[model samples]
Target: MSFGALSDIRIVDLTQMLAGPYGTMMLADHGAEVIKVESPTGDMTRPNGPWHTDDAQKTHGGYFQSVNRNKKSIVLDLKSTDGRDALLALVRDADAITENFRVGVMEKLGLSYETLRQVNPKLVYGTLRGFGDPRTGHSPYAEWPAFDVVAQAMGGIMGITGPGPEHPTKVGPGIGDIVPGMMLAFGVLAAIHHARRTGTGQFVDVSMLDAVLAVCERAVYQHDITGTVPAPLGNGHPFMCPFGQFPAKDGHVTIAAPHQSFFERLCDLIDVPALKDDKRFASPELRGRNREVLEELLAAATSCFTKAELMQRLGGQIPFGPVMQMDEIAEDPHFAARDMIVPVEQPGSARATRIAGVPVKLSETPGGIHSRGPYLGEHTKEILRRAGFTDSHIDRLQAALPA
Candidate 1:
């Protein structure tokens, strides 16, 4: 049964891998009927593994399961005329479709946006690419294939991230893909809304490089306004003092006391109340100017206490928190209270495996994870039947799929 906000919305997902699957996952979690149309071999990530020891049937690994959850899968060989017809049948009733293929892949398959729109004029076609589709705007690097690292570097995040200017580091998570995926989801919803109002749908294009650059907004304005290229400042902020990670007795803790009142309170809690009045740190501008000296002093004081001890001392008084790892986060009461970690019964595993919970909370109609990721072509017959295909037609379609 469908649950969550988008229960009436249907999506034909012709996307695979991290970026596209992630965007559709968000929609599926919110009760969209997401029909994942895959080829005969299935998504490439099905083979990527961090398999559970107890799960012998390794149909999909963690990477695939994590993003493809709460969706149905069907195998379709778009190269075949019958397969293309089947997809078009599904599209006729679908509100939107998403893909992440290269510039010419969809056109080669005879399933371009112009082609799909003919089947359903109200179809919102969303695409995520390294440079973006030509329908939105052409880029010089449109043909260049890119992954997370390439987007991170070319988008300017890597230029101003990491320990120093000499050593640019990629962000730990795949924000390059994930962010663009999120934007695609938002765009799809917006286009769908417009379609409902005016009975016209449009193409939604999101470039991975553009998404990353949008996220690195600070660097853009800083360079344009001040004529200075931004560089990595380690864990510290360019304008704020005492706003980065500091060493504790056991580990690191983050402290952000940039405001005057908060800074004074932080000084008092750390037993260095005199620092609030010091000429080098009396004002926010002065503290930023002499950040190195102030950080050294604060580090000396903070290093004497453990992370837990520091948390206890300044938990609510100032904006402070200990740097948490996965293990710690799993056991934390805050995560439990917020439902940030959810356990679902994995298909092959004897015990339930944990994945992150949905972050969006709606008071009236909340979203959730109702099911685990589907096995390859798990709902093919069911989906085909629902799309008005006869048993004989489904058999023909299945037979035509690549072996």
Candidate 2:
């Protein structure tokens, strides 16, 4: 298996849903052998839809396939003694294990970090929770069940993410889960690095609320430094004028002419050369203070050109972008040139399904989408055999697991 950078590592993934699975996939993308351990019932997303098939009758749908690529699946009924023993055996040689179960679920199952450490002292235990694992500290909401919306609301990202203060909105994607997942991947790598060096491993956790807050830190710092509770200012930035979306003849465009030189150049391109030196908008601070007036002036000029026309005039001279929908992005030459999208062989679909490709390019040892997510318990017997269980033992285990 020529997995990329983490090919030497093995991850026992007990995670379900978006957060934990997303993090495990990051490792899998870089060549780690990720064994996704599911309950007899399997990951909840296996039945989720938006299927790519014409009939939309696929066993697994887009949601599961999107984040779960490059991994294998195995089923273990952890309620049974045989299952627990099997996992302990697998853990004894594994590099890491990750889960998104609530505060005390693992402890109740007797598979807590303390117990797993006894099996594999170098096992890095990573978790994502709405609050956090109790091992770190008991959040008052430790036992409270949460999802992406809860984290976004509590974490301050939603507080400043909408058209205005009265209209705060959740972000378009599940950033609460996704960002924490990304951080957990980094945390696992760090823990594994230290464990390999010192022959010890530790529990690593990320609170979804904490991760969202960290990513939306500008709001926090703004509140602390200036006592100005940051609120959404439509599509523009707080510190820079002429740095947001503006309407064009056909669609929208964005310009980031924050610098004095860039502002002068933008003015020349727009045929409003006098505004570049006007006292009311000559400097960034002045422009910011009078952004309302400047935007009205800029919007009037920009509304004359189509998006493509603006791109032609201002694309290279200053920071500029066309507001691209997915259909446009699918045909964009830049994305194709960079390989930002690729195809994976999905089972139910007649042909391969396209998913976003790896953006973190490493020229010499680049990571990639290696394979599609496995079928439910697709490698159960194979994995048990690898764990030193004989065919007879595997037969017993499979019988105990749900078919």
The lDDT leader among the candidates is 1
Instruction: Report clash pairs, candidate 1.
Output: none
Stretches of candidate 1 above 4 Å error? none
Q: RMSD per prediction, one decimal? A: 0.8, 1.2
Please give the CA lDDT of all the candidate structures.
Answer: 0.92, 0.90
lDDT of 1 by residue, 307-333 (tens): 999999999999999999999999999
Task: Write candidate 2's Cα lDDT for 81-120 as tens digits.
Answer: 9999999988988999999998889889999999999899
TM-score of each: 0.99, 0.98
In candidate 1, position 88 carries an lDDT of 92
**TM match of model 1 to true structure:** 0.99
RMSD of 2: 1.2
lDDT of 2 at 256: 95
